[model samples]
Target: MIDRSQLQTVLESDFLERSFPVFNSPGIKDEDVMIHSLGCSVWNTLGHELGFMAVVEGPAPIASGNDIRSDSVWFDKADNTPLVLIEFERYDGTDRGYGKLEEKLGNLMEASMRWGDQPTLLVLSAWSPGLVSAPDFERLELMFRRGFSNSKGAKIPAPTNCQLLLHRLVLSESHTGLLQLQRMNFRWS
Candidate 1:
């Protein structure tokens, strides 16, 4: 069973590390080709590393039977269960990022309700390089934790391993196509 910590590591090494300035690069103007190809490549790399099958814009694994396409979904090698569902949101502005984040949370929450009891990692990977400050991540985490109600009735009770990872991109002159991650990992109850 893969724990949240292990999931964090894989997300960092396999996905985040591979998808850099290209993924979250503020420098790039034309992103037509890079967005299409790199998105699939990073997830493919992640799926290969963890022995899972990854797809971009694939249908979500919610039991609701509604057609919901997630940013990324990872299935078990046997091609049965979806072990992970990720939603990527670009941190555009102060007011905009929150709405996008909340929308992404809804996607994860639906999947969490369906598969949170099992070993699943519902991730909201946001790209906020210099837009969002460091301390605001705490506020973001608390805001997200509220999405999962402690009592299970209206709001789905998040799994013990429910985590929100906010990616802060930091550019370094040494690496040409790189922006390092300053991550704030929060475990929601």
Candidate 2:
């Protein structure tokens, strides 16, 4: 099973590259573009170490066998199985707009539900301009928990293994450094 720290350490270098443009200035960013960029970065940084090839906006595994898409998926090179699944979103403000996030979480839930038993990471990365407040973070966690349990016949999440990783990416505070990347901790609770 892949540990949270391992994934966290790999993505630490990506925080700046991923969060800068959106946080530095006032303009809208494209979620698809960000997902593609993340795919390149993840594969370049972790492909060899994990033997997984990252794909962007690829077909997801679902019971219905429909053409559902996932923002990012890392496939096991040896077995061609999806080992990491992610859904990315860029919310307008720190507060509100959780409905969009909930939809993304639902997407992640669907992809994870069909994945075979293995060491997998179901990720939801929601980028915000500024840091999310305590109440907002609480709501995010609650939404994930609710959705996770409702998926029937899904892999039971274990703290050390398969779990929904909810990440909040926000701009760094002035003291930390102007327009820098800041991230919050995540794992199924």
Cα lDDT tens digits, model 2, 1-189, are 456687777666554355434443343343345533643354344544555677767676546544557777777777787777777676655345676776676666666665653436777776655665433556656655554443344443322345667766564545533344455555454
The per-model lDDT (C-alpha) reads 0.55, 0.58
Question: Residue 180 of model 2: what lDDT?
Answer: 40
Give the alpha carbon lDDT tens digit for every residue of 1-189 in model 1: 336565557765546544544544444332345432544455556665777777777674445344567777777867457777767665655776676676666666666566644425666655544435333556656655666532223564444555555543332222444433444344432
Top-lDDT candidate index: 2
In model 1, which regions exceed 4 Å deviation?
3-27, 30-40, 61-66, 115-119, 129-131, 148-161, 170-189
Q: After superposition, how far is residue 172 of candidate 1 from its true place, in Å?
A: 8.5
| Candidate 2: segments with Cα more than 4 A from true spot | 13-50, 62-66, 93-96, 116-119, 132-161, 172-188
TM-score of 2: 0.64
Error of 2 at 93 (Å): 4.5
Residue pairs clashing in model 2 are: none
Q: Per-residue error at 75 for model 1, in Å?
A: 1.6
Q: Look at candidate 1 and give me any clashing residue pairs.
A: none
